[model samples]
Every structure is written in C-alpha cells, then in structure tokens.
Target: MAGYTVIDFETTGLSPRYGDRIVEIGVVKVSHEGEVYDAWSTLVNPQRDVGASRIHGITAKDVLTAPTFDDVAPALLDAVAGRIVAAHNASFDMRFLAAELERVGYVVGERTPPSVCTMRWSGAFLPGSSRRLRDCCASAGIEIVGEHSALADAFATAQLLASYLDRCGGRPMWGDEISAARAFRWPAPRPAAHTLTYKVRADRQPERADGWLDRIVARMPRSADSRVDSYLAVLEMAMLDGYLSLHEQDQLVEAAQSSVLSRPQVLALHAEYLHAMAAVALEDGILTADERSELDRAAACLGLAQHDVDDALAGAAGDDGADGLVISGISLTVGDRVTFTGEMRMERSVWEARARAVGLQPAGLARSTKLLVAADPDSLSGKASKARSYGVPIVDEAAFAKLMDRLEASAD
Candidate 1:
C-alpha cells in the first residue's frame, strides 16, 4: 500500500445532521517509508459559533478573516484525491467533509478514496490500554505538541501510525493481501427505495392515519446502524399522524419491542421511543387501560421511572397549548414560530413545542429566520453578536413560560 493522509477536523459541534459545520482542517501525508512527506492546515469560516472553543482554544475572532470552506475545498480535494484518508475517528471527519463537499456540488463518486479509522484499529490491536492519541503517543514514546490544534493532532496521529508500523516490523514490503486490505472503495449510494421519508398528515390525526407507518419505515436507511432509529421514527410518525387505532399502535409498539436487535444500546433507544409514543398516545386519550399497562411495562424494562414517564406525558399534552399566551397582558394563540438557545435541560422537542404554543415562531437567529428565543437572553452566544446582528427579538424561556402559565391560569 502507498502511504496515507492522516486527517483531523475541528468542527462547530458533534453532529453534522444538526447544521454543525467544520471550522478547521489538518492533514499530514505519510510516505510508504513511514515518514511525514507533507503537512497542511487551514481555518475555514464555519459561519457559526464555536461551541467548544474553551477546549480547542480556536474562536470566531481567530477565524474572522479566514477563507470559507469553498475557498479551500478545491485544494483539499486535490491533496487527498488518490490517498487513503486516515483519522482518529475517521467517520466523524469523513461524514462532515462529505456533507460539506456534497453541498458545494462536489461529487464524491463511487470511486471516492477510502478512509481508515485509527481509533478502531487501535482498540482491536492494543486491547486493555487507553487508545486516545495523547496516551498512545506517550506510551509509544512519540512527541506531540499543540494538542487540540488541527495540525498538531494530525501530527500526533501520524506519529502513532508510524509507531504501529514499527512495532509490526519496520517497513514490511506490501503484498497483494496487504494491498487488498488497504484498498479504497467508495460506498455505493443506497437505492432510493430504501431511503426513509418523514410524512405528516394534513389533518394531523394520529388514529385515522394511513401511510404514515409505511412512509416512516421507507425513510429509514436499510443499514444496520440505523435500524433502531428507523423503528423509533416509525413510532414517532405514528403519534404525529394521529391515525393509528389504539390497538394498531399498541401492536406496532409490541413489534418494535420484540424485533429490536440484541444490542443494549439499540434496545435502550427503542425503549425510549416506545415510552415517548405511549406518553403521546395516553395524552391524546387514544390508549386503553391494557395498552397503558403494557407501555408501563416497556418503560420498566428500560429502567425508566414513573415520574419520568409522567413528565414526558405532561410535556406531550401541553405541546399544543390549551390556552393562549399573554404578551404584556395580550393573549396570543399557539403555533407561532420562535427560537431558543442557551442552557436547557428540557428535551429539544418539548422546548420547541412550548415555543410554538405561545404564538411565537421558534427559529435560529440566522439571516433566514425572523425570530429568536434566547433561553439565556443576556448570554453572549444566545442574543449578542451574530444573533443580535440579525435583529431578531430574544426572550428568556422562563419569561415565555411565565406568559404561558398566566395564559393557562386565566383560561382555567
């Protein structure tokens, strides 16, 4: 095998699905002889907040004048075009890069280069020892500096790769077996028929719904990693559509509980989905006594408390407020768009529904949005800087909740 590119990216947040973007990238090219042949690093404007700046020490000000991802994408593509892209957590970097590249009209075709995850390999090979790059490097006597900086992390990863190669036997000649093991094959795009889609009914009735279950099942990726998510999506869609007969919904929940994989994590997520759906069903007055007992049993299987179930049920019931909000003593109806930020212990769905119930539109303070609900209205990130620049109104969640309380009390 001909060498590989050790890559790392400092992203705005953990998940790419939640609109997070990458702010910086680093790569160190290692030759077949296990020597660093070239190095590259760039700070790209993520166009958003650097949430974990305290840990990485790279801030919005540091990247203020930096080039956008588009500006440096071509060069980045050229550098790693034919090389294996290796990283500590390769999927994290790869998924974000792939999404961004796809957004900019870049075709990462079926022949796209392969990516190797050092973390996965290390865990398999170096069993019973810490696999973190810093710890691995220290144990292997490799020098690394500037821990969180992109280039520094890349360099550290490269050193670890080199050490692994040395321990295996310095500069072993590559053979067909090794070559095949290191071969790069692009992932085939899953067929459209297997893709999952989220569908909502015009009437928003959960019990009389047709096609909702099928639509949710279709939306789930046929991959093993997403099967649990697919089941959960089905349950949520059933609730949202309000078309499932109480018996049919109960059977569907039973199917999910019975058919889930043996993996505890997958089962746990399914349990949560079942619990949430049950709560929604109960609040909607669609569940029978027996079905409610079954759901309670499911929650017990997952080690969830009755109080937790009650809280979730309350949130679902209050989702579309029964009363209008009082804005300076003025009553405003529900379904209005609003936005929220800052510290919130409530589930995001619950928070979002509360915002909508107050006759306010929940939205992020980007140029595209018209409103902002700052949970911590005075916090620098919530309402100041870019959010303030967009001229969106910021209100604390507490204030919004207070208005909602007053409205409900008046109605009562």
Candidate 2:
C-alpha cells in the first residue's frame, strides 16, 4: 500500500506526435500512510521556441540556462523507476514521457513503472460536471497553487490521490492499473539524481561563430537563446567550409552535451539549419554540384536524414524564376500582415524578402498576422492548430505567391 508518485508535465503542446515536447516536470511521492516522501521539479530547456507561451506563461528567458531533457532524463528515470506514476491526465503526461524516453533510446514499456490517471477516477470522487484539473480540485476543495506549473500541479494531483484513497478506506486497485500502464512500456532508464545545477557562463560574450552563419543566426532574432547560440556556433563552423571538421565536430558535440538538448531538440535544430540552407539554395538559380556537395556534408554534420535532405531539395523545384506558373487572383496591399507554416516552396528569409519588396509586412508565427501561408492547410503543427483556433485564413503556396505578385504589381 505504498503511496504512488504523482506527476505532471508542462509541455509545448498537447501531442508529442506532432513534435510537441515537455518543458517542465514535477513529481510528488506520497507514502502508503498518506505522508509525503519527496517532491522534485525542473524546467527542461526544449532548445526551441517554447510554444503557446501565453497559455503556460513559461517564457524562453526562464529556461535560458535550464538543463535539457536528456540531462534530466536519468533523474526522471530514477524518480519513477519503481514507483507508480500518477497524474491528473496520466495518459497525456505518460505519452510525452514515453516519447522522450524512446527518443533517448530507452525501451519504455519493459523498463518503465506503472501509471495512474486521476482524471478517470474523477467521476467516482468529484461531484458535478467538469473533469478539468481546476474543476476537480475545486470539487474536492483541494487548493491549486499555480495553475500550469508542473510542481504545483503534481502536488495538487498528489493531494487528490490521497483523497481518493481516503474515500476507498482501503488499498485502491493500484496493481492492475500499474500493469495496464506498463503495457505502454517506455524506453530505458539512464542515471538518477535528485537535482541538477547549471553553471552560468562567466564570459558574457560567450563563444561566437565567425563564419557566414553569424549573419544568418544573428538575423534570426528567435535563435538568441544560449543553447541555440551554441547549436548555431557549431553550424557556423560547419558551414564555413561546408564540412564539419574533426575539431568542429568535437566542439559541436560538446556544445550539444552542454546544452542538454533533448534528442528531439537536436533533431529540430538539424532541421532548422537544413531549412536555412534550403531557403536560399536556389536563390541564385539551380543548386550547383559544389553547392549540392557542400549541402550533403552539411546534412551529414547536422545528422539530418536523407528524406529531410530530399525535402529541402524538393523546394528548389518551385524556383522556376519568371518562367514559373503564377496562380493569380489573390490581392494584397502594403502593410498587410502575413505569416507562414509548413515546409514552404520558399525559405522564410526569401518569403520575408519578397514581402518587403512588395511593401507588405511579414509576421512571426504567433503574431497577430492576417494570413498564414501553409504548405498543407491540414497540417497538425502548432502554428496551424493555433491559426485554426484563432480563425486565421490559411493559403497555399500558390496563393501566397500570387498575393505577393499582385502586391508587387500594384506597387509598380
């Protein structure tokens, strides 16, 4: 009848399958006698844009020096190794945890402990309507300290679990549920630790990349975070000669390890640099053999998959210059707000440049943009989801081009 480990996670979004990731974790272990054994929490630097910041209130600045998921994976594994993991929405947090563990090469189901979803049992305990965390806590009269913070949520969930057990007056059906959760087997466990401390950089300037990539990363206002800076520094070196040298590889690995970037973050960054390359590869016309060769090495250094590389190249097919077929009828004026999602035919830089050329304005993903140009209107990406939720109009690449062309013509 030992108490279970109640857990909670603050993630970038709801689904891990859509490349959403966990940004924070909190856990509270309650003893069988209803006494609290331990509590732990940490902010995970996802090494990318912490999406839906408005909802979670976790600003990028908060995770500036936070450890990456892999760095904290061992500790998380240690915490949940033998305990039963419980959460308000256990499946949601469990899915994210499982995805992260598998990403790091763990065999989730076999090595993982069981889990409990407090949400399912809400009907048995909480009175009235909603199964939402806040509602359930309210029904039980349990106080929720911080609405979305992982630590606060986990602690509250732990309190709720105690209430559930107290209601049953006996050891609840914990064993079967544990086994059922184990059926979702997560990946392997690494090391275990109670906490991790990060050292602030003594050098204010930090290390800078002197290559052409400096301009690129510099212009990207979003890549200003510490881990991203390090990631870009390695890419800067790699792009200098189109091949990451042995020395550069060492630096890259060191930076990556130091950043504690989760496996997905690393993959995302790799996609980023490749996207940067693709955005401009065909700007001067066709990709020369030398350019193509350099890109191949860059892809290897970035650890990008062949399919990703091919996808980058596929965008080049749309670069047919003035001879390209122009899908017309769309119109736009100067100062119109525009944004983009999906893998577009044009790179972000080129898209922005084109927008400026026509006296139009380009917007960031989450900005109050009027239009969202998407490669596929049906994408499940966070941007597309948000756009759909906000009732933003989504246009295809052809429509986007036609709009831009119309604007250009009007200006002339």
Highest lDDT: which candidate?
Answer: 2
Residue 400 in model 2: shift from native, Å?
A: 51
- How far in Å is the alpha carbon of 390 misplaced in model 1? 51
Best by TM-score: 2
Q: Which runs of model 1 end up more than 4 angstroms from their true locations?
A: 109-113, 170-412
Taken over the whole model, the C-alpha lDDT of each candidate is 0.54, 0.63
| Regions of model 2 farther than 4 Å from truth | 109-113, 179-188, 192-195, 198-412
Cα TM-score of candidate 1: 0.45
Per-residue accuracy of model 2 over 264-368 as CA lDDT, tens digit each: 656666765665565566666677776676667678877776677777677545543211111211236777788877777778789988888877678876546
Worst 10 residues of 2 by lDDT: 321-330
Error of 2 at 167 (Å): 0.7
All candidates' TM-scores?
A: 0.45, 0.46
Q: What is the C-alpha local distance difference test score of candidate 2?
A: 0.63
